[model samples]
Target: MSLISTSSPSSKTLPILRGQHLHLWFDHEKTKALDDMNYAISENEFVAITGPSGCGKSSLLNLLGTLEIPTGGTLFFRNQNYHDIQDLALFRRQHIGFIFQSFHLIPTLSALDNILVPTLGNSQQKKDVTERALDLLNMLNLGGRSNHFPSQLSGGERQRVAIARALINQPDILLADEPTGSLDSINAQQVLDILCEIKQQQSLTIVMVTHDPAVALRADREVRMRDGKALDMTQVLT
Candidate 1:
């Protein structure tokens, strides 16, 4: 990964993420998944990406989350050019948190263990991290289910566990891909409410990709994509 540090042109606002001319492609694929995309997300903002299948919503999220490098162009996180740095792994561990539709909880581990998984290796305040995880779980109404394994919990409960895990590290940004997918309508709304609440309570910056219109509506701004390009964009109050 590259690392270049520079403040945004408008320092009055906190631009936590910025991407310029981003183009990404898979090997042997002639078409680019993300083509010359440019966007910026400010601190404590909730931005949502919406589009039909294969519109590159997830791909864009991956790039912003630093899970993948752009084939061409640049990504800046906290005023640092991410591609300039080589320590991509450390960068992800320290600055990014991820949530997914599948929950991605370790099937073998209990809810508590799943929340503690990311903090297992690499350095952090262990006691504080563990306590924070528990606190998050409690806040999500999962306190009584701490020792329950993923298989034993309801779908909504498991996703709650995933959310708790993602926030354990107090990451600079949160990237969620279809976080409410694979759940019933009621459960999906509950998870969405929790996400909005977390963003408000912690002043967290979140970028989420969702196919659901209601879920997308919760964000402060929405970017629509089609054929690997951002189409129309708009902002709405949460």
Candidate 2:
């Protein structure tokens, strides 16, 4: 799993996302979660951010996911200033897929229903989302569990359903915050393999936060952090 390769560029190059000396403060005056983080994520690359707990890895992920805006510095997506974008919901729906460590599935919703949740209240997506959701369930090997609710499934199965939910929108990038952190060894490996397969099949750019060295080694590039800062710029994959 130590094998590493620079992401070979395609005939056409696209600037997917970039962060310039970013900063994030949980509390504007007291707590600073992220400090001076600068990184670039290329098209169709799998990049893992690894570090000790509370080192701002998740905060960095949140900023990249566009779920939280940085306190300072510039963030760009598709060459446009993301902080200035007026409609984040539309932007996220078009380009980003997010998976959290908690699984975050509604207790009352069935696996299929959970996966289709993002497509609701929208005429274009709601029109043909059933088939898409079903396909994702099948892809994640949860086809038989479609009718099962969160309480009825194992931790691994629930995470897989969450993954299906993230992918239901056919997003360009998938952001995962410690995706396999809650699973057993066998289940973790299964989830890792599925992520790799889907990344290749869908040509996705994945930015994942992981504490597991084995999991970090599987990524095309690894960025290490400490004390809410990126350790070095040269350590990143270009």
Candidate 3:
């Protein structure tokens, strides 16, 4: 199992997420999708990963999300070595939140229920979970839409529900892949604003992948990738 010991503030100043010489290959492939990539993301930092379609940006996110393990190297969350963790599912459930471009909400559930989905595994009181979900939905400006189903909401509203669902678990890190891809420009900007606000209000550490330069420009740090390698291209905000 992964080590769960608490360290001093000195160590807390260390990266909240770090990849040590990460490498990945898919199913006996001749080429590696991620070639010995190394990255360190600090607590509460907003980072963006950008690249062409095949540049391994999503692979990097998968590795960081613990959905995929590296063929070589190690990924650490706080002080824990993820590959050493025995109960990965529980570990992830407790710590990581994900937002996908597709808005993966349950089709039959109302927006509020979709937001409450993650809390089903938790032992918190129902009132507490409902309160948390309501707070997030209201903050995302979807309070009036809570009773609606996924099909009844607009694209942006659906994505807001998806974002609320991700936050229900109160995760330490949020991973988003093209979160605004399907929205109109106004909706995209609205989603981006909400993301920034949440990061600031909750002190969240976010790692988002985007093809849009506009989205990349919104991050505190932008990392660009090409041919399975990433490089720090710009620091737009901090």
Candidate 4:
């Protein structure tokens, strides 16, 4: 199904992200990771992509994050076609952040260092980047654990560190794949609360993939996928 925009025509802003008839194939086109999927996300919206295993949840997230190129169809970022973007890597760094189920933190690096990893080799001054990283750590409530490595932190702390790293670049969009899948109930809820708070505070557009209905309900809207296609997209009733 095409996930058409429901916004009023009087609105001037365009969707921050949109996918039109997107397809991603594997195994010589035998495996359709995404088949004619259509989706859109507005600025500052929190969207959850929910489906069972192998239903292309992660694939869709990858496409949105520019980590994977679609084999067919087109994607747009605020009306700019993906194919027109000359530098995918730079585009991702400037506009997108990613969180994963595994936390994806560097075990050997301190929390502050991990948060600063994305700023490496960039034109941003070292002093400024360090200041931003420290600020993010403090914002995420890790003010006292800047020196702690991933190995030394608890599951929730590690996830918060990952979140800080993702936000270090000040991205406009956050693509999270099963962000709370690895945590227990309490930690999962805490992480979800953090995401919601960050979204409101930073005006970030979040696209999260998960199989948990409870988690999906936490989002502003839920897009249900099946057989690599979006079956339904509806706003969650508060």
Model 1 Cα lDDT, one tens digit per residue, 1-238: 5585554466437488887788999875686899878788888889888889988888998898777778999888866899787788777777889999999999999999899987887577878887888899889999899999999999999999999988887887899999988899999999989989989998889999999999888888888888887885333112
Per-model TM against the reference: 0.91, 0.92, 0.92, 0.92
Per-candidate total of colliding backbone pairs? 9, 0, 0, 0
Question: Candidate 4 residues 1-238, lDDT tens each?
Answer: 7699766543236788888899999999999999988987888999998888999999999998888999999998987899999999899889899999999999899999999988885799999999998888888889999999898999999999999989989999999999999999999999999999999999999999987899988998888889989886343211
Model 2 spans with C-alpha error above 4 angstroms: 1-12, 125-127
Candidate number with the higher TM-score (1 or 3):
3
lDDT of 3 by residue, 68-121 (tens): 888888888987888789987788788889999999999999999999988887
lDDT of 2 by residue, 1-238 (tens): 7576567544247458888888898765477788888887788889999999999998988888788988999998866799788888888887888898889999999999999887774567564798888888898999899999999999999999999989988898999999999999899899989999999999999999999999999999899999888788886536
RMSD of 1: 4.2
Regions of candidate 4 where Cα sits further than 4 Å from its true position: 1-12, 233-238
In candidate 1, clashing pairs total 9
Deviating ranges (above 4 Å) for candidate 1: 1-12, 233-238
RMSD to native, candidate 3: 4.0
RMSD per candidate (Å) reads 4.2, 6.4, 4.0, 4.5
lDDT of each: 0.85, 0.87, 0.87, 0.89
Worst 10 residues of 4 by lDDT: 229-238
